[model samples]
Target: MTVRVGLTGGIASGKSSVSSILAELGAVVIDADALAREVVAKGTPGLDAVVAEFGDDVLGPDGELDRPAMGALVFADPGARRRLEAIIHPLVHRRSAELEAEAAPDAVVVHDIPLLAEVGRAGSFDAVVVVDAPVEVQVDRMERERGWSRAEAEARIAAQASRADRLALATYVVDNTGTLDDLRRRVTEVHAELAARA
Candidate 1:
């Protein structure tokens, strides 16, 4: 059977790194963020819907979605964010399900969803893996690694469910509070366990 692993975490929590390790170990990694962008590309139905609702202000001069402008509008207004999610979430869900169905028997398909906690899709998977760190560490990593301001980082964090909530849904937890090597070790361990299970 295909093992659908929902991998999630807060911003800057190293989910991508861990997802990469899982991919190296033969897991088919489906990244929701990448799909989110794809579904809204210039000619997609999702983008048409977004343009119909949000107007042309969200479009860049090149006719592509202005992601930063869209992000600002959503984060500043909950209703707008929900509207955006309404347009994008279904597309992500459909594509992810398709990928899951295509995976081999005994395949470990890892879905890296950044907002898995907020989106409430953790239970859709065979296993939920949460990558986490202390609040201070998360903020620091966001600011230093992502160049987000402290307030911006905090706002993003606040928009999602708390770390405790994420852990409550997790079947496995990877604490990313240290060096990359430490994170790699954890990923390797999880990979081995997943391989054995397969």
Candidate 2:
């Protein structure tokens, strides 16, 4: 049987790094963020719904979704953000299911779902691993690595549930407050464990 693992964490908590390591270790990783982008690509129903709801201003001159513009609007307005999520989340779920179905029988499939906790899908996976870091550490990483302003970083953080909430749902937790090597070691350990279980 395929082992379905849900990997999640706060913004800049190194979840992506951990997920990448798992992928390199031969786990089939279905990245929700990548699917979110795919589902909203120019001609999809997701893009059609978004355009109808938010109008042309949310599109760039090339007629593609203006991510920065839509991001700014959604982060500032809860209702707009919900509307956008309503349109895209279902599409993402569909695509995720497809990916899961396509996994090899012995594959250890990791669904890197940022909002796994928020969406109440924790039980959908055989195990849920949360990559964790202190909020201040996340802020620093975002600012220094991503070149995001403090306010921008904080806004993204605020959009998600508290760290405590994520931790409560975690079947396993990998703290990411340390160095990259440290984080990698933790992921390597987890990857081996998942492979054994598979």
Tell me the TM-score of each prediction against the true structure. 0.96, 0.95
- How accurate locally, in lDDT, is each candidate? 0.89, 0.92
Q: Give model 1's TM-score versus the native structure.
A: 0.96
Clashing pairs in 1: none
RMSD of each: 1.1, 1.2
Question: How would you encode candidate 2's per-residue C-alpha lDDT over 1-198 as one tens digit per residue?
Answer: 899999999999999889988999999999999999999988888998999999989998887899999998997898999999999999999999999999999999999999888889999889899999999999999999999999988988988999999999888899997888998888899888888888
Tens digits of per-residue lDDT for model 1, 13-58 = 8888889888987899999999999999998899999999999999
Clashes of 1: 0
